[model samples]
Target: METVRAAERALMARLPEGTLMQRAAAGLAAACADFLGRVYGSRVVLLVGSGDNGGDALYAGARLRRRGAGVTAVLLSPDRAHEGGLAALRRAGGAVIGPERALGAIERADLVVDGVVGIGGKGGLRPDAARLASAAERARAAIVAVDLPSGVDADTGEVSGAAVRADLTVTFGAYKPGLLIDPGREYAGTVRLVGIGLELPPDPVLQALQHEDVARLLPRPGAESDKYRRGVLGVAAGSARYPGAAVLAVSGALRGGAGAVRYVGPAGDAVIARFPETLVSDQGPDHAGRVQAWVVGPGAGDDAATVAKVLGADVPVLLDADGLRLADRDLVRGRTAPTLMTPHAGEAAALLGVRREEVEAARLTSVRELAATYRATVLLKGSTTLVADPGGGPVRVNSTGTGWLATAGSGDVLSGLAGSLLASHLSALDAGSVAAYLHGLAGRLASRGAPIAALDITEHLPDAWRDVVRD
Candidate 1:
């Protein structure tokens, strides 16, 4: 996983006057050069602010000017600009203009570089700044943000105020959380990281998934495997009120490479009807025979009796949906077997005793905190799904899936697949993230254009697995 850090201690160790800024500018200019087809006569606009962020943009503008591109800097605050960078830009034939002149130049520019704020700014764009950002957003020109979209909080992926929506964002040194999450992520568009001579340690925050990591972690069947020997997943989900969740969960389990799926809930009849291969047992968890893992929650509702029965199982358990609601953090902490949690933003907030917005803002942090607090592996679902282990390791973000996955019961399928993988002996963290990766891909495949049913998402799991396992 690639992570963005608050500060790179190694970079701080050697304070060479302008090395960082120079590297940042060179990277920015190179990236921008791709967007500017013919710089000799093309117009480029730079949205300048007060800090080192503006210095980076100004210096890049100087480089662009040398390449014969017509560069114009829109100084948000002329009194507080980076003096050295401004001088360099001026010497290289780059023109600086206030907000009034900026509006005209921005309208006609081919490219816009937002250097308004770096990682240090707070609470979005100010009133005047917001106007400029808003205006730039409406422009037809391609927009690129320096470091990040001006108003986004780098540490937490939160947008507290108005922010510039960019076509691309070139980050320095490492990726900040903002570039990988929603709200802020939406504004950031596509992110490209530029290593600026900063050797960062392992990030406390995590984002994005790489193929090699996923391939190493995903479970594969070995020789001498049988139905029971492989592992059986006991699903205790759904209620009479909502039996579709049971069918969906069963669908996911059936395709999850499990030995067999034992349905042990009120909705067993529904599951058996949909998937005749599933062992139908009207009995509770205690009487449902043996299984390697239990998947609880989904549409179980507020029934305490059903939840208790599922909780009594001896196998490793994956809890989601209603299971998250009835979950006692203390009980989860006491479990001997591994426990994995799959919660969306709202459910996570409920589990962590915080607001939904808070969980969404610091998704990586929230998932890790929940893992530690409950002593379980946690999967926080959203655009960038985060998976973290209580013991501590890199938290992985699932880069797959689209907004269309917000359909109903999609999470139920995720829980069942994750539980099945866990039953097959993968570690809780690996199981959760691998299942998520497959689930997200399944959703995208199932919903090529329109929204797909939750059961449809489950049906596509095998196809997704093939895509991942294949070259």
Candidate 2:
């Protein structure tokens, strides 16, 4: 946000005075009106602080006052209020009150515009501002943030102290990194972008994949398509103890656009029983026929040998769960073929030699660092699944997942699906991201607002895939 704001200021200077402010105020006022359905007689409260953010609120409040809404400004810093904006509000018949009176207005407000801090503010809300935020929450009023929700680190999406939880966030020019990521994204509610004509760089540090992006990347069969021609995804998962892991991973692979699935593990019987179509081989990966890619892990028990053998293969490999734990770091780093590592927060933390909380708090940095460390593509799975290549380019963020998708064995399904895509000849980064998108969509469809089993997710992969392609 600092860099963006610097660019904004430079652009503002090049334009006429108050031009940027007017543009921001105009967009903000329109958003406020749209949110507050019948503007006439609506109770609007503005949490005005001491900066350009406050100016935007005061100006928007002035517009609301003219439209027959009773507008009240809660001034946190009366002396530091925007002079023109303050005067404009006064002329438009809006009342100004200090913090003591602010709580009363907030309690009765139909809508609250949070202008307490803009993107530049750090940490969280102060004592007085925090009180207003709390009161507004208790009031259950629809709150629209002027720029960003106060207290969130615009760059890192980290929230340190008390921050405003808004119903809608109206941002100017472009989308900030914080609004698209979690922790901050959860607080932001529904984001509505308000353009004010500030030119930004062509590339962003992070990206979220939409339906079109996924649609274009999905693999398709051709005239020469067959089991081997389409792709053969090898499954080196499961054990005598957890043979169901092999069944689940194989189930995912069958529907993941792969024409064939080869099973090479201790649970060959289990794989054959559940998926009779699988080509079973207990002789391990070397003799598992020709597989384009390998999905190692899930429930391989403590079998480090299988993980090692699969990693040693010249084919692309995806390491998940137990495979992630058993694989040797030096061997993995030395691999010439494409490598993809899918780790939850705990696994990523262990690999980075840090606490899980550290990894969770700064997911962008952790994922990027892990990719560089392994010289491979890294998919950090969480509420927001992220995929990054070894090169420090824009990371792809999956926006399709729900909390219901966190069920047991879900990661196993993801591993098989992604591995299938890898076999079908997509790059490591594309395969991981596409798998996440489809996995999340399937989870949503299977759950339908209820708790879902891992098996349910595998069943819904076809539906998710059809929805993407059909769209």
Candidate 3:
């Protein structure tokens, strides 16, 4: 938010006063008009506060008033409201009501514009503002938030106390990190970005890779490439108790860019039965034939020795499930080769020695902290999977995952998919991000609204890949 504020300030200094505000108001009004379909005779209510956001709502209300809609501004702080905007609304024949009448106006409105708080305001809404937010929520009107949904942390997606649950969020200039991540993302129903032409920094704090971004990162083998030349992924997963984990992991690895998948575990027979293409070995990862990268810790039960051996390997490794629990912290941090740790909120909570609730509440902080502590790329898996590099540049946020993906053996598939990408020479960050993207898309494709198992996700990986690469 400091970066966005600084950029806003820099842009404001060059332009005339209120130029940015007008631009925002114009876009907001246009979006509202489009949403309403017929602007004439519609009842529009503005929940105006004391910030620039309030002015934006007021100006937009004035625009709607001119279009023959009955506009009403319910000012939370009447005296502190933007003077110019208030005057414009009055000139356009829009009614100005006190907070006392806010609820009734909101209920009667066809559209409710929430400008009670802006990006600058933090924590939660004040008591009076909170009541209005509640009224807007319960109202039969469509709620549209200005700039950002009030009470959501623009920098981190933490929602403390009362926040606006908007049907549509009209954000100006740029997309805030909160809008892209969870908690805040859930609050913001459908985001509509209105470009105000503010020059932002080259390196963003957060990034959400689209299909084109994933397509560019995906590795393609040449005509001359052999199986070994493409990349061989070593799978050190499963045990006598959970041989299915090995089969599922291999399912994902084969679909991933890896040329060959070498299986080294107690599940060798099971692996061979499911995937005859896999090079099965009864030996440990250390004894297993040379491979480009390794995926360890999915259903290995208590195999600490196998986890240690995979960590000692020179190539990149993806640690997940039981492996995340058994692997030594010192060994993981000391490893010279790239290491990617994929942990669900519960596993991450254990590693950080905090409550799982805390990790879920503050995912951004948890992921960054885990990455720094382990000196490895951390992919914190959840409703929104976040991939953060140890050094920290841009934390990639993945929102493509469905609730259907929260099934058994799903993490195993993710581990294998990510490990294969690492073997194909993608950096730890790229591997995690690309794997998450495809894995999420696969979940969506397989489920299609019904329930789906982990195998369904692996089965649809090719469709996800094709969806990304297709023109």
lDDT top scorer: 3
Tens digits of per-residue lDDT, candidate 2, 224-308, equal: 8888899999999999989888988998998898889999999899889888999999898889899999999989889998899
Better of 1 and 2 by TM-score: 2
Query: TM-score for each prediction?
Result: 0.91, 0.95, 0.98
Q: How many residue pairs clash in each candidate at the backbone level?
A: 1, 0, 1
- Tell me how candidate 1 scores on lDDT: 0.84
Ranking by TM-score: 3, 2, 1
Itemize residue pairs with steric clashes in candidate 2. none
lDDT digits (tens) for residues 192-214 of candidate 3: 99999989988998999998899
| Model 1 spans with C-alpha error above 4 angstroms | 1-17, 353-355, 391-393
Cα RMSD for predicted model 1:
2.7
Candidate 3 segments whose C-alpha is farther than 4 A from its true place: none
Q: Candidate 1 on 1-471: residue-level lDDT in tens?
A: 233332544565577777778889999999899877677888999999999899999999999999999999999889999998999999999998998777889889889999999888889798878888887878888999999999888866778889999998999887877787776888998888898866667555664665566666666667987899889999988998989888888888888878898988888777877899999888688888889999988898876676666666667899989888987667788888888888999999988889998898777678889999999889999877888889887777788887788888888888889888988888888888888888888888998988788878887888888787773
Give candidate 3's error at residue 97 in angstroms. 1.5
Candidate 3 residue pairs in backbone clash:
297-323
lDDT of 3 at 242: 98
